[model samples]
Target: MSTRPHLLYLAWGFPPAAKSCVYRKLATANSFARAGWDVTVVTLTEDAWIREQGVDRSLLALVDPRIRVVRLPLSREDIETDIRRFSEDRALRPRTWLKRHYQQNVSHFPEATFGGWRDELVASVRRVYDERPADLLLTSGVPYTFFAPALDLFERNGLPYVLDYRDAWAIDILRDRPAFRPDSPAGLYEARLISHATEAWFVNGAIRDAYADIYPDRAQDFHVVRNGSDVAIGTDKIPMRQPGPDEPLTFGYLGTVSFSAGLTRAVCEGWRIAREANDVLRRSRLEFRGHMGVGANRGASAQAVAIAEYAKHGVSYGGPVAKADTAAVYEAWDALLLILPGGRYVTSGKVYDYVSTGLPIMSVHEWDHAAAEILSDYPLWVRNDGVEAEDVAEAFLQATKVVQGATVEDRLTARRHAEQYERYAQLRPAVERLTTRFAPGLDHVEPVGDRAPKTGEDVHRETSVPGPHAKGERVVLALTSPPSEAVRRSVALLRESGAHVELIGPDSVLEELRGLADEVITLQRATAPVKVSPSTSVTRFTPRWASVVARNLGRRHIIGPYVRVVGRSAGWWLSARRSPPAMQALKDATVLASLDDSATYLIWNASRLNTRAPARAGIGATLEELGLTRI
Candidate 1:
C-alpha cells in the first residue's frame, strides 16, 4: 500500500453534473487533494448526468487534475424520457412497468429505485480497498446508500468513514419534518449509519438539530458545515453597478427554478401585481436565468410555463447561465429576486452567491424560512410576509425602492455583511479540522493563495442571529387545510400540557378548528396550484381499471412465461444500457426516501409550527418523542 493517506469520496453529483451540489463536491475533492492527500472521487458516468440533469463540461475544468475521478456505470432508469428506449411492455403500461420494476429493485435494497445498485457499490468499494487501500472514506448523500459500502468497508477492514450530508436523510427539507417513521427502512438505515459513522457533517444547523434530535446518543458526532459560495464567484470579482436613470432596475433570479409550482406561480403573479402597481416595476423586467427543471421537462416545466405565461407582465426567462459567467450576469442586474420553497429547513445553496453579489434581494418564500435567518443581517434584503400576490407585490415595491435609493455605501455594507460567508472561509477551517483529526502526522498544506483573506477564524466567532419570533413564547399551529382527527387529538394533548396554542390557516378552516384551540388566526387563503403537467394529471386521475390492468399484468401467474422471458431480456438490456463502471468502485447506491404520501407535507408544516413553541409537539409521534404529553 502507498505510504500517503488516501481519501475515498463517494459523491453521485460531482463535477460535470451541472447540478447545484457539484459546487460543494468540487470544493470537497479539491480541498482534500490540496491538503496533500490522494483523493479519489467515485461518481456516476458523464452519460448518466447527460441523460438526467445534463452536463456542463466547463465545470470539469475546475476539478483538480491530481485528484482521481472514478465514474460508476449507474444511471436513474426512472428518468429515461426516450420512448424508443422503452420495452414494449413498459411502453404499453408505463406506470405498471415502473411499479413492478421498483418493487423488484427494493426487494434487494431499502431504496425503491436505487436498491439494485447496492451489490455493485459494495463490489466497487472492495476493489478500491484491494488496490489503493483508503485510510479514510467520506460519502455525501442523496443516495444515502453510500453508507452501505462505508459500513461494509469498516466491518471488513476497520476503515473509518465520515458522512458529508449536504441534505437530510430521514428529515424532509421541503416540509421540515421526519420523512419516514422511526421503524421504517430509511429511518433504521439512517440510525445505523449515524451510529457507526466517525463524524457526520450537515450543511446547516436546522439539519444538524434534526439529526441530533433524532439520535440524541449520537448528537456529538454531528458537525455544521455550511454550504458556501464557490471562490470563483467571490465578491471581489463581481463588478458593482448602480442602475442609471434611463436603465430600468433589472431584477434577476439566477438558480434552478425547481421549487414547487405554486411558489413559482406566486413569484410570477407577484411580479405582475407589482408591475401593475408601480411604474418602475412596469418598465423593469424580472429575468429568471437558470435550469428550469430536470430530464425531458428541462426548460418546459410548470415553472417555465408560468414564466412564459407572465412574459407580457415584465417577466422573462433567460435560461441557464454558466458558473464562469455568473459574476457578469449579476453585475448587469441592479437587484435580485430570491424565490425558494419550503420552510425552516430549506436554506438554499444559492443564498451565498446572492449575498456575495451585494445587490438588493426581494424574498419570495415563507416568512420563517432558514434563508430569512441567514439574510437577517444582510442590508439589502426585503421579504414578503406571505405568499399572497399582494404581500409579494409589496415586497417587490419595497425592493425597487431599495435598489433605486441604494448608495455605494449601502452596496459596500452588503458586501461586508456577505464577507463572512465566502466559500473558502466556511470550508477551510472544517477541512483543516477533519484533516488534523484523521491524518494528524501529515504536514499542514499551504492555503490557496489566490482565494480571499484568511478570516475563517473571525467568521467562525460570529454567532447566528435568532429568528424574529425566537423571543415570543407562543405556540403557533399552521395548517394548509382543516385539521384531521389525528391533528385535533394532538392539539388537545398540547392544551392539556399547559401550552398556549394558536391555530393559523385559511379563514374557512380556522373557524371550524377555533373551538378546539385557545385562539385562531386566519391566513386568508391556501396554497394555489400553478399549471398542472400531463403526467401529474394522469397520475392524479388514473382510472381504477388502469391500475387493475397494471397490477394483473405485473403478476407472475397471469403471464408467467412472458414475464420470465421479458425479465431476462430486460435485465440484459438494462445491464447493457448502463454505462461501464470506471475505476471499479460502486456502480449503484440507494435513495433515502420515496416520499409516497401527502402526510410528508402535513408533517413538514406541523414541524415548522412546532419549532416556534417551547414544547415542540405538533405531530403524533413527535409529541411522544419530545415527552410533551400530559403526565
Candidate 2:
C-alpha cells in the first residue's frame, strides 16, 4: 500500500455537473490533494448531469490530475428528456409512473430521487476499500443517500467520515423547520448518519445551529464551513471598473434563478419604479445571467417568462455563464443584484462571489436573511427591509446612488471585507482539523479494523438557534392558487403555534409556498406522453410496426402538440386522484383545509377519507376550526 493516507470523497454533483455546489466540492477535493492525501472522488457520470443541469466541461479542467474520479452510471429518470429513453408506463402516465418510482425508491432509502442509489453507492465504496482502505471519508449531500454507504463503511471498517451538508437535510432550511418528523424515515436516517459521523459541516452558522438543535447530542461534532468565493472567480476575475460621470451602469445578477415568479415581478416592479424616479437607473440596464432552470425546464421557467415580460424596463435574462467565465461576467457589471430566496437559513453561495468583486450589492431578500448577515459589514451594500416592490424600489434607488458615488478605495474596502470568505480560508479549519485527527504517524493511530480516534477538539460551533416548538399537530393544506397575503399569514400562525404545515399544490406555485410551509408537495400534472423512439431500448417492448407508427405520429406537428394538450388536460383532471403521497399525508393530517375554491374538491375528498381531521375552506375557517383564531 502507498504510504500516503487515502481519502474517499462521495459527492453526487461533482464536476462537470454545472451546479453551484461544484465550487465547494472541487475546492475540497483539491484541498485534500494539496495537503498530500491520495484523493479519490466517486460521483454520478456525465450522462446523469446531462439529463439534469447539463455539464460544464470547462470545470473538469480545474480538477487535480492526480485525483482519481470514479463516475457511477446513475441518472435521475424523471429528468430524462429523450423520448426514446422512456418506458411505456413512463411515457403514458408520467405522473403516476413517477409516484410509483418514488414510492419504490424511498422504500429502499428515505431520500426520494437518489435513494435508489444506496446499494450501488455501498458497492462502490466496498470496491474502493478493497483496493486500498481509506483513512477518511467525506460525503456531501443533496442526495443525502450517500451518507448511507458512508455509515455502512464506518460500521464495517471503522472508517472515520465527515458529513458536509452544503445545505441541511433533515431541516428544510428555506422553510426554517424540520423537513420531516423525527420518527419519520428520512429523519431517522439523518439522525443515524449524524450520530456516527466524525464531523458534520454546514455552509453557515445558521444552518449549523438548525442541525445542532435537532441533534444536540452530537452538538460537539458539528462545524460551520461557509461556502466562499471560488478562487477562479474571485482572484482571477478583474474587478468592476467605476464608471465615469453620466455613464450608464449595468446591474448584474449571476446565479441560479431559483426564486419565484412573484419575487421576479416584485424586482421588476421595483426596477420600473426606480427607473421612473432616478436618472442613473433610467439609463442603467439590469441583466440576470444564470441557469434559469435545469433539465427540461431550462430557459422556460415561470421566472424566465416573467423576466422576459420586463424587457421594456431595462431588464433582460442572459443564459448561464461558464464557471471559468464568472469573472468576465463580474467585470461587465457596475453593481450586483443579490436576489435570493429563503430567509435566515439561506446564505447563498453567490453572495461570496458578489462581495469578491467589490461592486455595490443590492439586497432583494428578507432583512433577517443569513446573506444579509454576511453583507452587514460590507461597505457598499444597498439594504432593503423586505421583498416588497416599494422596499425593492428604495434599494434600487440606493444602489444607483452607491454605483454613482463609489470610489476606488470604497470598492477596495468591500473586497477586503470579503477576503475572509475565500474558499480555502473557510475550508482550512475543517481540513486542518481532520488532517490532525487522521494524521498517519500519530501514536493514536490504530489498525483499520479497530481505529476509533478520540474526539478531536471542537473546531467550530455556534449557540443553538431556537427551533419551532411542537404543537403535536400536523396540518395538510391543499392550495389551488399561488399564496396570497392571507395564506402567508395563516401558515405563519400555524408555524408559530407549533403545527407542522404541509402545503400541497401544483408545481407552478410550490416555489412560492416553500418558504411558508414546513413541507411543500407538488401535485403532479401529467404532460404529453413521450412516444417511444424505434432506436431506443424502450422500443423492444412494442412491436416494430407500432413503434414506426408512433414515431411518425410524433413527427406530425399538429398531432404532437394536440396529443400533448390532451394529455395535459387529462393529467390535470386525474391529478387529485393520482396523488398517492398527498393522499397519504391527508390521511395522516391532524387537520385539513383548502386555501382557494379550486382546491375544495381535494379537501372535500380528504375530509371524507380522513373523517377524524376537521376539513374547512379558506384560511380563516381553518384557523377558527383549529381554535387558533376566532371569527
Candidate 3:
C-alpha cells in the first residue's frame, strides 16, 4: 500500500447518490484528492439512491479518479421500490407503521431513518480502517447519524478525526433554538459528541454561534465552512439570456429539495398570492428545477403539491437541474428565489449558483438567512422575513420588474457579487484548515479505531433475503385507513424491537382521517377500511401532498402540531420528493399492507391508551420492531 496519508472520507450521499449533498460531498472529496491524499468515500448503494431522489450518474463527473468510491448493499426500507417487495404490513397500515418505524429509528439515534444506519456505518468504517490505515478520518453529516460512526471509531482507538457539521443536528437554526431540551437525551448526546471533536465545520456563522453556546469551552474549534457554489457547476457557457418584450419573465430555483416542507408551502403560497395580487406575476412563469426529493418518493411531494396548487398561475415543476445542467436551469430563468432556512446562519449551496447565474434575485428565505450576507451586495434583490403572502408577492413583483426592466449595468452588478463564492475558493481553505489545524483528543484529540494497515474501497454488505415474502420471515398484520390499527400495532413492534413503547389507550377506537394532519388527531372521514392491494411498494412515487392520503388513516403523530411552520420550513424537502414525515407515515401503512401486513404499528396501538407517545423514551429495544430495520 502507498505510504501517502490516506483520508477515510465518510459522506453518506456521495457523488453517485445524486443527493443534494452530492455537490458538497463531491467538492470536499475532490479537494482532498487534489491535496495529495488517497480518498475512499463510503455511501449507500445505487439501489437505495433509486428509492430517494433517483440517481444521476452524471453528477459524478467532477469526482476525482484517484478517489475510490465504495457502495454498500444497504437500501432504505423507508424508500423501497418495487411494490411487489411491499410487505402485507405496509399495504395495510402505512402511517401508523411508519411512525412506529420512525420512532424506532430515532431510538437508535436522534435522527429518524438514519439512526438505524449507525451499525452499518460503524462496521463499514472499521472495515475501511482495517484494510488501509488512514492517517486522517474526515466525517461530514446532516444525517447526523454519521456522527455515530465517527464516534464509534473514536471510542475504540486513537486516530485523528475532522467533523464537518454541514448543518447542526440538535440545533434548529431556523428557529434559533435548541432542537431538543438541554437535559434531554438528544441534548446530552450532542454535548458528548461535540466534546470529542478535534474541529467542527458549519455552513454559516449563525450555526457556529449555536455550537459555541452548546460547548462554550471548545468555541474556537467550531469553525465556519460556508456552503459555497461550485465553479464548474456555476460557470455558464451561455451567459444571461434576456426575455423578449411581452414574454412573461421566468423565475427559477434549483437545489436539493430536502428538509423543511413548510418552506416549499410558504413559497407556493407566496406564488399563489403574487399571481392573484399582481397581473405581472400572474403572467410570469415560475420554473422550479433541481432534485425534488429523493428515493421512491421523487418528483411528488409537498413541494410538488405547491407546484400543482400554483400551476394555474404559471408555476410549473421541471424536475432535476443537474450539476452539469445548473447553467441551463439558471439560464432559463429571468430571476432567482433564494429560499433558505436559519436566519443569517444558513448559507445554502444554491446561493453560489444563484449569484453566479447573475440573475435578478428574490429572497423567499428567512429575513435573516445567511445568503442575505452574500446577496446584500447584489443591487437587484428583494428579501422578506415575514414569509407572508404579501411579502412573497412583493418579492415576486420586484423580481418581475428586474427581469423586465433591469439595465445591463444591473446584470453586471449581480454577476460581480457572485464572483467570490466559487466552490474552489470555499473548499480549498477548508481542506488546508483541517489538514493543519485538526488533531484528536479531549481537545485537538486523536480519534479511536482499530489500527491496522488498510487501503482501497471497502463497502460491507449485510445479509437480507429479498423476495415476495422475504423468505418466510414472520408475517405481520396490517390494516388500512384509521391509523388506530396501524399505530397501535406499530407500538407493539416498537416495544418488541426495543423501543420503550407504552400503550396509552384502549385496543379499539374510531375517528375520521383528513389531509396533511396538522396535529395527531383521529382519521378524517373514516367511513370504510380499504382492502389490501398488491400494487404498493416502498419505492413508489407518491404525489407531493401525500399527507392528504395519510390523513385518511387515524394515525398522525410523526409531525409536530404546527403544520404551517413545518410546511414553510420544509420547502426543499417537498420539492425533492423526499419522504417527509407528512408523507412517510402514509407510505408506511401503504407498503406494510402490500406486503401482507409485515409491519409493526406503534401510534395506532398507543392510541388505545388514549395518550400521547412518551417523550422521555429514548433508545431502547422498540427500535427493530418499529420498522427502523427497514429505514
Candidate 2 global CA lDDT score: 0.76
TM-score of 1: 0.71
**Per-residue CA lDDT of candidate 2, range 1-631, in tens?**
5788789999887889878888889888887876778899999888887666657776887887879999999888766544334454554455677799988889889988878788878998799887888999999988888888789998899898999988888778778777899999888777788888998998888888877788899999999999987745333235446788788889888887889889998999889998999876788899998776555455555676677778888999766677766766777788889999898999989998888778899999987999988898999998898899999998988888888899987887888888788887788777778878887443232211211222212111212223334387899888757865535765787889889999887889887668888888887543334445667654444686576656555545654465475454233324655678787898999888766545655665566778888775456545545555311
Model 1 Cα lDDT, one tens digit per residue, 1-631: 4566799999889878878888888888888888878899898999788666566666787888888998889887776643334556664345677899888777766788788788998898788778788889999887777768898898899989999887887887897777789898877777778888898998888888888888999899899888876646443446556765556778899987768777878888988988888877778888988775555344445666677778788888765666765766776788888888888888888999888877898898888898887899999999888988878888988888888888877887897788788776677877787788888877778575436443322121212222212121244444445654545655665566655556544466667777876776454211122224566543533685466446445443444455355443232222222323210101121000001121122223222333332222124322332333110
Q: lDDT by residue for model 3 over 78-185, one digit each (tens)? A: 765333444545533555557888888888887777787778778888988888867778788877888776777777867667788888877776676667887987
The candidate that wins on lDDT is 2
TM-scores, one per candidate: 0.71, 0.71, 0.68
Residue pairs with backbone atoms closer than 3 Å in model 1 (clashes): 121-586, 124-585, 175-604
Rank the candidate models, highest lDDT first: 2, 1, 3
Q: After superposition, how far is residue 574 of candidate 1 from its true place, in Å?
A: 27
